[model samples]
Target chain A: MEMITSAQNSKVKNANKLKKKRDRDKTGQALIEGYHLIEEAYQSTVKIKQLFVVDVERLDEELMTYAEEVFEINLKVAESLSGTVTPQGFFAVIEKPVPETTQAKQVLLVDCIQDPGNLGTLIRTADAAGLDLIVLEKGTADPYQDKVLRASQGSVFHIPIITQELSEFIDHFEGNVYGTALENALPYQQIPSQDNFALLLGNEGEGVNADLLNKTTQNLTIPIYGKAESLNVAIAGSIVMYHLKG
Target chain B: MEMITSAQNSKVKNANKLKKKRDRDKTGQALIEGYHLIEEAYQSTVKIKQLFVVDVERLDEELMTYAEEVFEINLKVAESLSGTVTPQGFFAVIEKPVPETTQAKQVLLVDCIQDPGNLGTLIRTADAAGLDLIVLEKGTADPYQDKVLRASQGSVFHIPIITQELSEFIDHFEGNVYGTALENALPYQQIPSQDNFALLLGNEGEGVNADLLNKTTQNLTIPIYGKAESLNVAIAGSIVMYHLKG
Candidate 1:
């Protein structure tokens, strides 16, 4: 077993570079930390390029066989690669899964969601709702970001999430394209659930772009019965996704 | 106008101490940052004990009259008091609202929700769903914490949140008390919506406490259609909340 004790080791340095979007995009790989996510990646169709663990003895037998390479890393290396204050001591470098080419029956189209946590939660909720695909607008937060991967709770590996211009995707999509809005929209309950549909959720402060909303098959809103001005984007998206999944 | 240029000033030091839960409990005050939250506190019935501002001109005129005492603080003092990387240049010391003694028709009972962000999002979602009151179990994250305040997005000011034992509250409650569970639970949609009901949500890792689940009128779950293990606590709680609100 190869041991890498220094944070400056080439393998460790290269893995640390994956923390940035550009590096991940260029290399077609992502760095995932913690045990659960690494296990999820191993179970999924995604390929594990390398594994860095502080305790080789603690690595799952199944995961050890799956990884192409494994290295024993010290606490310093683990800390340097981790985004969190308390590094979980397990990290995996995995190749990004290719997007599915088949047409998805049910989809969740995210438009300009700026917050990584919100974006990640949406992915997890969509996965649980059994949406076939998640289409991210160009400006949405990068799914490979550590905050998103952690927040998704490993569901990112379970689901098919791809980045594409939402407008272009909407142009070709054939379904009940339901956009959420606060005004001039029927209550979400009034809209009948459809087997093939795309639910569009937008930015936190600015909702679905007006041009995009115009293109939607119908606009709907969840009624606000309290003093809160509006629901959080992720929360609102989850309610609509579950309702539509029916 | 009094100007506070030093971070160590008695007033500034005292205000900063409210950041800790122990100090907040002892003083009966919580420190809130950002322009939006400060505005929300001013509009609410809650009393604002002190206001620290980097720029007095930026403060809302209405809020100016609402705060008991306003101090112009330097950037250094503002940064010292803020939890965010970039301070919004506004902070306030507010007394926690007195929980309403009257019985609430629709309530949200949170049991040992440990994550501050999840707790805050639940509070915001409950407020949006128009749940009348939020009852937090003692082990749950402090709603007055900085992370909770930021994640709640000022919904904390709109609703009444009080900490209490789940068992005692359930024993006295008259309405339907719905607890969420993964097994031996009916689909949430199968349950009829009731005007007077309490929705009980539990910790992220643990579902509703076994003892609490045994006491509820019914245990419900949102169906999982994908390979994902389960929905996020906040997401799951939000889905049930909007459904029950109907």
Candidate 2:
């Protein structure tokens, strides 16, 4: 096994750059840390470009066989490539999967969600609700960001998430386009559940873009019976997604 | 207006100490930052022991009038007391509200939820869903922590959250005790929506504790139809809380 003892080693340096969205975009690859996430990626058949592990003997046999290239990295190199305070000692550089082109019957349209944790939890919730795809508006946080990935708990590997102009997507969407809003909207329960639909959730401070809300086939709201101004975007989105899926 | 130019001012130092859970517990006071949260505390009738602001002129007149002691703080003092990168220039040291003595009809029982964000969001969601109260088990994250307070978006002020033993509470409870579990649990929708119920949510990794699960009137689960292993605790809790409140 090749050993990467220096943080400045060419492969280690390149993998470190993949932490940024711009670098991930330019190279079509992203770095993921920890054994659980890497295992999820492997199980999902995402291409593993390279693997870095502190202990070669402890590496999962299947991952060992499947990795295109494996390097034994010291604590220093692992720390450089890790996003977390405590490096998990296992990291992988994997090719971002190509988005499936098929028109999804059930979709979650995320509109400019700025919080990475909320965005990631929404993705995970959508996956659990069996949504076919997640369409993120341009301003939404990058799904591959470390916080987002960790919050998604590897559901990012299980679900298809793509970035696109939400307005254009809604224009072409054939099924029920349910937009959540505080005003001029029916209670979410009043809307009949449908087999094919797109649930639109908006930014935390500002709601669904006005133009996009206008394009939605129906707008709905979960009634706030108490003094809270509103529900968190991820929480609101999850409830409606599950309701729609039913 | 009295000015506090130094971070070492006795009052400023004491307020800073309230940032830690142990100190907050000992003093029965917690420091909350940002304008919105402070306003919420004021509206909730929580006792404000002291108010710290960068500019007295910019402070809301009502908050200024209501605060027991108002101190004008400089940027250095503000930065030292703030939890976020950019300080909002408003801070308050508030006494924890006494738990309401009356029994709540709709309750949220949280068991060992370790994440501050999850715990906070649950509080916010319960408030929005019109749940009467939130009962936290011993191992759950401290609701007064900065991360929890911020994630809660001031909903902590809108609801009563008290820590109590789940087993004892369930034993004396009058209505249905719904424990969320993956095994031997009915689909959440299968249960009839009832006004008086206690919804139990557990840790992120572990489902409801086995002993607690056995004590519930009914164990329920939100269906997961995709490759994702489970729903996030807050998400699952919100869905059920809203359902039971319907």
Candidate 3:
């Protein structure tokens, strides 16, 4: 039942600060932009810090009743705080999700999927496939990024996504680790599988990290026959995820 | 070489007009933003109407030599003309590429791919697959869209892309059309010869249009052992492209 009238308000200032990845990481806060993203995040039960409604007159009472704290900003200030040009007039600052450190059942790991859209889509697909957890290595883009979050459409909220050292967790589980590579790899379908597994996706250019590759139990590829140097990294990852499903 | 200082200058106005699809379609010349895309258009021997450059003093001579008419704009104008924030400092008001009408040896017919990223990636993939032509039916996004252009990385310039009356072209080809679907279609790997083919990609939500599906010489589905609902459109197209290769 609070309204933040000034962009200079301490809450607005702190909310705006979450735009940077460093800030999000340091403070354990994530920024979800636009009406749809925030709605998805809400539906997924991400803990909210504060809500900023640009035009209070237009907001329905149903949405207003859900927020713990609400603030109103002029369109300009809302746009200033928003990353996208077409601001949705509403935004939220929410706490970062802490995924459970579970024993691997089935996992999709992204090495360095750089394209945010692709990365988010990959995560969404992984979640939709009923995979237990998603792991991101050191160089991968932040899964909490605004664009990635928006592209994910709130899967980031519910999905147990973790970023950790690859070597730290390499030998900790008892499942096969199948990574995609261009050469000396079997076709994805040809690789026989058991129930417990982890499928690794390499970076767009360099592919799976060398350390992880050396430890991988199986190496596989899509059996590409055309002239494409390689398929898009996200597409490759999605295919592997689909192929590896138990 | 003329420097356009005022945003209101007539040519500057025309150049700026290209920022939106309505303007682009109205003028028959589209704004190809970013250095790589302009480079792609220029390298392809396509005619350039007006080459808009910014920070001209910083450009290399190779790029400088390719422009027919050049104008200098500030970063703001360049940003306005570009759809993305990181303006490439160079944009081209170029004629839409029309590839030779030579009978297509193999064609790709796409139906209602709504995502620009997906459509652009498909176009780029089609080019990589050595496809002879690309056909976009109604409900397809503009191929000249900035996101598609960037995602395609200029492959559109080389590929013969057509957005036209689907029935007429499908009628003329008389080649076997393979439409992708969920079930009841032959596994892609079992398909016959590669030459004289048209591959149909449909909407992600709706699958192929019924009219086009009826017209398909055959219906095919990629063999999937996984539980994922469907492969990403670009990946699905690539998998089929790989399988259909002779």
Candidate 4:
């Protein structure tokens, strides 16, 4: 274990750069904060590159045992390195896992979901529904964003998330792609259950992209019964994902 | 129309105090920001007590005609009074509607849901599912909190949300009360559909209070298919609500 007291330390500065999407992409390393998330990541195959801590006493033996390297940093440095309002004394830099091809039939393909919280919730929901994979199009919010990680409740560590262009994914995917949209869509209940299917969702404001929607085998809609114009994107996605998990 | 330049004006000071829970409760009035929410409130039966705007030109004729009173304030004053990071130039003080007895068959009972965004999302989901009402237990986040309102996306204006003790609500409610928990609960799919039912959701950390759970007609669980510990409270509530909306 190394003690890092200075915020100006070269390692600390480099690790902090993982906060940006470009840096994370370039290095294939993302920072996961909080004791819980770090512990989850520690249990996963994703390699932990480094661990930073304000106090080692707060960490469990399992995390310490699994960690590749540990650094004890001062509170000032910890605060500067932290992303959340309440820092939980531990952060891990983990190598982003290589995107794995999905073998299972049920999948969720998300297109242009810009909200971090929505994207995180969708990932968590997909995990809970027993879906095999979640495919994100290029325009979706970064899954590595701190708010996304926090909102996901550590599901990011569990779920297999892959990012690629929606058009290519839809064309290459083996299952029937069911797109979600408001107009010219069958009520979600009316769509016949399939043994192999992919659920596609879109941005918060716009429905699924027109060209993408046309490419899907069918489009589905969750009926809004009350004065509410529509359900929040995450909630709508969850409702549909759970219903179609059959 | 009234033009107020001073933030220290008596009405402005009184309106500002509504930001606090105690003051909102005492006054039975809460501020709703943004053109969309204000417009929703204007269309609803709920009385608008006062409307504040930095730009009179942005106010629609219908809103101006419907508002009980309108105040034009300086941009500096508007910014100072705004709750959101990006203020939408319009704010309204709306009288809290009196709690009415629910007439429909479906209801949602939330117990001690502490996250404002979760509570709001749950309410919005309930609205989308055509639930008759939302009963918030005392420990739940205040429905009128700015974050809650923003998260609800104006559903709060449409949904009938009432606060009362959970014990009393369960005892008096006409429909079957279905509680959600992780253990010793039937998978939500296995639970029989009810003609009239209330879905009960609990806090983020602790599940439903045991005493309240005991009083419920049945306990339901959404099975976790992956390594994720659990779904976000709002997402979990939504899946159950939509599934059981039979």
Return the top candidate by DockQ: 2
lDDT of 3 by residue, B158-191 (tens): 7888887677788888678899988669877577
lDDT of 1 by residue, A95-143 (tens): 9998777789899999999999999899999888888999888888999
In DockQ, how does model 3 score against the reference complex? Answer: 0.22
**Which residue pairs clash within candidate 1?**
none
Put down candidate 1 lDDT per residue, B48-134, tens digits, no spaces: 989999988898877878889999999999999999999989999999888777788899999999998999898888888888899
List where candidate 2 sits over 4 angstroms from the true fold.
none
- Residues B1-246, candidate 4, lDDT per residue (tens digit)? 789898888878887888899999999999888888887777776788888899898889877877788899887778767997777778888898776775757889999999889998988888888888888898889999988988888888788899989899889888889999988798998876566998999999998999999999889999887787888999989888878864
- Candidate 3 lDDT, A1-246, residue by residue in tens: 466567787887888888888899899997778776777777767777778887778766756677667777778778778888888878888887677777768888778788788888787677655678888898788888887876665667656888887666667767888888888688776765457888888888788877788888888877543344566777766666655652
Model 4, docking class: high
Tens-digit lDDT string for candidate 2 (B115-220) = 9999999999999888888998998899999999998989999899898999999999899999999999999988888889999999888878899999999999
Query: What is every candidate's C-alpha DockQ against the true complex, given to 2 decimals?
Result: 0.83, 0.85, 0.22, 0.81
TM-score between model 4 and native? 0.97
List model 2 lDDT by residue over A153-185, tens digit each: 899998888899999998898898999999999
- In model 4, the runs with Cα more than 4 Å from the true position are none
For every candidate, C-alpha RMSD to the true structure in Å: 1.1, 1.2, 5.1, 1.5
Which consecutive 10 residues in model 4 chain B have the weakest lDDT in total? B96-105
| 2 against 4, candidate with superior TM-score | 2
Model 1: how far is A137 from its true place, Å? 1.1
Give, for candidate 1 chain B, the lowest lDDT window spanning 10 residues: B37-46
Once all C-alphas are superposed, what RMSD does model 1 give against the true structure? Answer: 1.1
Interface RMSD of each: 1.0, 0.8, 5.1, 1.2
